[model samples]
Target: MSAPRFGRITAGPAAPAGGEALSELLAGGGARVVRIASRGQVDPEGAWYDQAEDEFVLLLRGAARLGFADGTERSLAPGDWAVIPAHCRHRVAWTDPAGETLWFAVHLPPA
Candidate 1:
């Protein structure tokens, strides 16, 4: 077995201009944990994500908004979370531009 690992999720490279920075923290048994840093990022018009895995998203800092294909929207602040089912179309509607918005996401294989 491998030794355990530990680190700060908030400690990472900055998000690129007009883009987000993604760090894969762990992956095994068809599941993955990721840390995402964003600043003033949003999906392009008509763009959406349809993932094969279910996603659990937790907002750790700043604020954000998520838009669904069904014309619904959800706002998120620090400490807020949401679970997105596989193939559920969604997009990043907005993110705080003044500072970094950190997100912790766990992706698990669809049931």
Candidate 2:
């Protein structure tokens, strides 16, 4: 079998002007990895993420704001990492409008 390719995590083209792009990097055995490119995209009104698996996410570049159901918010800068437990309600409150925000998210031990 061919070996898996390992390369720059910051690869890929820029996200569109005002939309967010998500690409699955890996997935197997109840776990998955995804890369997100955001250009000022925010979670829709009253929408929340109730993921089935725990997620460990890192802000690769740019900045973002994450919001929880408890009404607290977290601002993320490059190199910031967050581990969110499964079932915790959360959302992307905001992202950098002037530039692209890159994210690496890994879902652990699926639901």
Candidate 3:
């Protein structure tokens, strides 16, 4: 059977890990869509880049910070959204403990 193509609001269980949390809303075909809940317990390790797809992230709940390759940092809170271009090196730097960091991440084919 083929997967249904449409729009909806889907929620799933929390991710199991220490660094990042992810609950996939859709995982099929050429796409792996998910909602990310993160708590930056520590700075990210090493330099990382996404060559296959650009990541689109939206802060759905909680507060956090992001560090980029250019050494620039930004604090994020609920209702904030950003798009990280493909192949960009970046990392999570910090987060608030009062609440669990929740964000939506949609990965798309690279330009």
lDDT of each: 0.94, 0.91, 0.70
If ranked by TM-score, best first, what sequence of candidates would result?
1, 2, 3
What's the distance in Å from true for residue 41, model 1? 0.6
lDDT of 2 by residue, 4-55 (tens): 8786777865788778888888888989999989998888867999988899
lDDT of 1 by residue, 27-108 (tens): 9999999999999999986799999999999999989999999999999999999999999999999998888999999999
lDDT of 2 at 11: 82
For candidate 2, the TM-score is 0.92
Q: Candidate 3: RMSD over Cα atoms?
A: 3.2
How close is every model to the real structure, measured as TM-score? Answer: 0.97, 0.92, 0.75
Clashing pairs in 1: none
What lDDT does candidate 1 reach at residue 104?
98
Q: Identify the leading candidate in terms of TM-score.
A: 1
Clashes of each: 0, 0, 0
lDDT of 3 by residue, 46-70 (tens): 6555457788888887788878888
Show where candidate 3 strays beyond 4 Å: 1-11, 14-18, 49-51
